[model samples]
Target: MQKQETTRIKKEDKVKIIAGKDRGKIGKVIRVDKKKKRLLVEKANMIKRHVKPSAKNPQGGIIEGEGPIHWSNVMLICSSCVKPARIRMNILDSGEKVRVCSKCNENIDSK
Candidate 1:
């Protein structure tokens, strides 16, 4: 029997917020929780949480941080033209696969 691969998005990918209070905000994916289908985006959808004192922090206090947002609420942003566009996979001459921006036909990982 052959093993199957999970087709979930990965970290460091650019994404744009499409819903919630932080709609339209774009940021790079810092982390992904596949079990929860939530993602932590850099500088996007920030929230405040109060913490109790512990060994690490003698004086625990309120901290501002980023919260996980649903994957359905975000659209992948293309690195090619630096815009929020749909993605389409393509094969290069060297047989390498790459994602392309459906709008600009440019390579997403040109950088």
Candidate 2:
């Protein structure tokens, strides 16, 4: 088995949808599936999935769910400035590491 490499995007992180039908929409990252390299952005790229009737559901119905979107199609939205910005690793004097926004030079986690 091979260990998968991840890009380190986290939940509650603001992001901008850059591709697919949800292009230009901005939202917080609700989930990150590292194994699949997919992301579930809050209120982004929703689709209906039809499912057969089960014991719980007597009738088959269409389920509204969030579809997996590739991570590449998303740009990290700076929490501080509230804009889509690139992330840069910064080390504090105390050796604490954090990601900062390249655009505003503000700490992405400060917000």
Candidate 3:
């Protein structure tokens, strides 16, 4: 079995696209695929899906939505600084690991 890769980014985290067609775009991470090292960001990497007619949709047609982008293409946006910043894993005295913003040196995880 393939092991899941560790990622600094998490679901619901705001991120800025650094590389790709959506470069410089900022959006919230909707999902994280650790194994694929991809992220589904809100309003980024828009894609069109041709949906067939089904009970869920009476008139299925082209649906536009966010598509998965490579994790390396995005940078975490630091809440404290309100900018896309690098992150470092820090182990607290309580033995809990937390993500710290490289620019502001603030905890990324909310209390």
Candidate 4:
């Protein structure tokens, strides 16, 4: 897939998992991989990894970490409504475009 120039989801944005095993779980966006079309959500999509003893992990047994979830599997939760909503862009009076929730028409981005 082609890399998107921009994404509606950003780090620290609160999001809700709409699909996959973690569906209905809500968490903050930890990071975004635009090229892979995935987002690392905090405490979602947990996966186990077996690692050998290393400097970083002396015990190096089984470890768990957040796995990337396809962006399509998640939706932004509107702050005002506290529910999942689709986002739309609109130009403000100052001509600055901002993301807003389609369900509530509230600003998704604080800026």
lDDT values for all models? 0.82, 0.84, 0.91, 0.89
The residue ranges of model 1 lying beyond 4 angstroms of the native Cα positions read: 1-9
- Expressed as tens digits, the lDDT of each residue in 14-104 for candidate 1 is 8989999999898889998888878999999899999999898789998899999988788887766777787677999999888788999
Decide which is better by TM-score, 1 or 2: 2
Kindly list the per-residue Cα lDDT of model 2 for residues 6-109, writing each as its tens digit.
55578888789999999999888889988889999988999999999998877979988888889888999887787888778799997998888899999776
Tens digits of per-residue lDDT for model 3, 73-105: 899999899999988889999999999999999
Question: Model 4: how far is 58 from its true place, Å?
Answer: 1.8
Q: Write candidate 4's Cα lDDT for 1-111 as tens digits.
A: 645455698889899999999999999999999899899999999999899999999988999999999998888888888888877889999999899999989887764
Assess candidate 4 and give its lDDT: 0.89
lDDT of 1: 0.82
Residue 56 C-alpha lDDT in model 3:
89
Q: Residue 93's C-alpha lDDT in candidate 1?
A: 98
Q: What is the C-alpha RMSD of each candidate to the true structure, in Å?
A: 4.6, 4.0, 3.6, 3.0
Off by over 4 Å in 2: 1-5, 54-56
Among the numbered candidates, top TM-score falls to 3
Residue 88, candidate 2: how far off, in angstroms?
Answer: 0.4
Error of 2 at 11 (Å): 0.5
